[model samples]
Target: MSRWILVGVLWLAGASAAFAIDQEIAFSDPSMNTRYLSLIREIRCPKCLNESIADSDAPVAADLRREVRRLMGDGKSDDDIKDFLSARYGDFVLYRPRVSETTWALWAGPFVFLVIGGIVFWRIVRSRLGQPLDDEESAA
Candidate 1:
């Protein structure tokens, strides 16, 4: 039992080591480093769905990190870097996409769906309860 446990622990350690991602950041200025960290935290990895480039281990995430760093080194503002990524990968690359015509559905879709659902639910409940929808209908 001890031998089996030892093997299991060693195997788990090796697996964890293999799955570890590089968390290094190279920036000359402290402010740039701060911005870089912020950018990474705010930018989603296109290939990783819900994971940010900072948290994802995918190759695409590494590539995005490199691109963001390079853009910063080129004196691009945070907005510029965000725009570059958003232009290339669309609003999904941005964790907080701006509200615009193209993204209106993304911003308002849930509420619209909720309102529609509420109306349907109200109608279903009213019908099941044999309640009249209007006073005129009840009188007739």
Candidate 2:
């Protein structure tokens, strides 16, 4: 009976805590609220590395959320908000970084790597299986 009661208390505490987190800050305008949600999901948390501000529970994520809300309240345009964050934290803060001189490497690096890998893989497969092995390879 004691164990059961403790389990019940734990369950309730977990439920309440989950609800307490990620409470949306109310906005006077519906459009602003929509922008707020989008901004949080679009912005990366420096502490969490790959996770968005919306998905991160880090203290820095919380601060970023507050800053987004404050900027929206000030009637800043979405581009303005993005530019401000980009300037302060660098392009790493944006989920889809703008294609600029500095960010070209990030956007193109993956496709370049993929093409190089594919070429290497093709060469390896061709050499190994494209035809019967040469006499020297067969001997080895």
Candidate 3:
């Protein structure tokens, strides 16, 4: 019975330890915590599609969270931190890449495709509504 009690206490401690945030990021400033959270929400987890770094439990995401905190500690503005990470990684690291020449296709490709699809649909409908041309009509 004593051994079981000891095991229970150890289990509770271990469970709490697992949920604790990284010690290095115990910010005294509440604003810093808020800033970090906001920045993490905007950063994409490279290993997880459609998941922000804040929501991802992957190791890479954890490292990125720490790095963002470190950069915040260094007094980097949000844009500066984003630019730094974007430089190290790529635009894919950003949840929303900035609009620029390189990303013109990324920004406009979907709309262009939609327009093209609409034109094709219109042509198909028009063709289907027209009378079918028989060989006699063609000869005329």
* Candidate number with greatest TM-score: 2
lDDT per residue as tens, model 2, 1-140: 99999977865554443344566344646456556776778899988898998778999988887888888888888899899888989989999999999889999999999999999999999887768878998999
TM-score of each: 0.59, 0.60, 0.58
Query: Candidate 1 residues 8-80, lDDT tens each?
Result: 7865554343235443435646456656776788999999899999789899998898898889889999899
Alpha-carbon local distance difference test for all models: 0.81, 0.80, 0.79
RMSD (Å) per prediction: 10.4, 8.6, 11.4
Predicted structure 1, TM vs. truth: 0.59
In candidate 3 the C-alpha lDDT for residue 47 amounts to 89
TM-score leaderboard ranking: 2, 1, 3
Model 3 C-alpha lDDT per residue in residues 1-140, reported as the tens digit of each score:
99999977865454343244443443557567656766888999888968888778888988888888888889999999999888987989998898988998999999999999999999999987787778897899
> Given candidate 2, what's the lDDT at residue 101?
95
Judging by lDDT against the true structure, name the best candidate.
1
Whole-model lDDT, model 2: 0.80
Best-to-worst lDDT order: 1, 2, 3
**Over 4 Å off, model 2:** 1-21, 108-140
